[model samples]
Target: MFRQATRLLVRPISRTGSRRFSTDLPVAETADESFVEAWKKVIPNIEPPKTPLSFMQPRPATPSSIPSKLTVNFVLPYASELSKKEVDMIIIPATTGQMGVLPGHVATIAELKPGVISVHEGNEVTKYFISSGFAFIHANSIADVIAIEAVPLDQIDSSSVQKGLAEFTQKVSSASTDLEKAEAQIGMDVHSALNSALTG
Candidate 1:
């Protein structure tokens, strides 16, 4: 009697649920080696198919002690803001609230709102106003922050921000269609956050 070599693994998909993996359903870590080997033996001409695991970097194991620093990679569509920068802590504008992330933080994916992301390193703090994005915090003290539009707070023009805020406020009240109203509201939110980041 032969037994299956595959072992099952379960992981959380949401706040209160989990999904199970089985032999019938495959994952990157459980790619069918037997099938690949058979294919190689039969044809020996083509390369074996690559799994998602092969394309992804292996996750580092969690350390025993809380790390002193967190590795951050802040990225934008046009440029990479911070590449593997080690920082003491970072404050992100999450939808729920401003969340301060530190080393050894539990793995989470935070939906960022229009606000400022403050990267704190010792006594130096760098601030940037982001339109919106997501932050992925991993268990290995690494955080990947992705934003669509971000600019240094110092580089922003206060007068321009105020002017835009006024325009958006007028647009909000004058908007006739639902789409226009939503766009105006979004513009207002972003400007409000920008104003707060500058003033606060």
Candidate 2:
């Protein structure tokens, strides 16, 4: 049988003298020293939360730096007092309803229905009528409003609008499919409603 024993030697030592302890067998002190060294190195790299209770700090959100000015292109004969440089807010007819877009707005794409398009340019407001089209605005404080058919208020004729309404009503009544019927009905109803509302 193997037995391990420890020995102790005592002597009168001075107050500043070093005391030593010895073991019967070899023991590793390097492991403890290495572990402590490793922990010290890892502590600085670990991140601490900004808050007192949190474990990690949150990253800051990226800022959107948008430029000034807006460019609008309309396929129809629409005119506006707003210049490409002075536009701030845009009010246009969307498939759902009227959409009001302002500066620093989030990016979006929308389908425009037939209705009056009002754009807010600084202190002035401009209005135009648009047919089926799409518009795109960016978070960068700029918008490129292009449409398929655009008609200025002064350029829009009552006779042509009335004719479109009558034809649309007929199409809506006899539409073969749900999709066709809905589209025709929406267009007709929107145009009719706009004529009444804007002309009033």
- Runs of candidate 2 exceeding 4 Å displacement: 1-83, 174-190
Off by over 4 Å in 1: 1-57
Question: Candidate 1: TM-score?
Answer: 0.75
Candidate 1: residue 37 Cα off by (Å): 12
- Please provide, for model 2 over 1-200, each residue's C-alpha lDDT reduced to its tens digit, 9 standing for 90 to 100: 00110011122222556542221111123323333344445454543222221232332232456445555434433643333554767787888898887766676788987777887667887777766677777545655666666656767777777888898999999999999999898879867965764576
Each candidate: RMSD to true structure?
6.9, 22.1
> What tens-digit string does per-residue lDDT give for candidate 1 at 4-45?
111111222224445433222344344445545545665567
Q: Model 1: how far is 144 from its true place, Å?
A: 0.7
Q: At residue 53, what lDDT does model 2 achieve?
A: 16
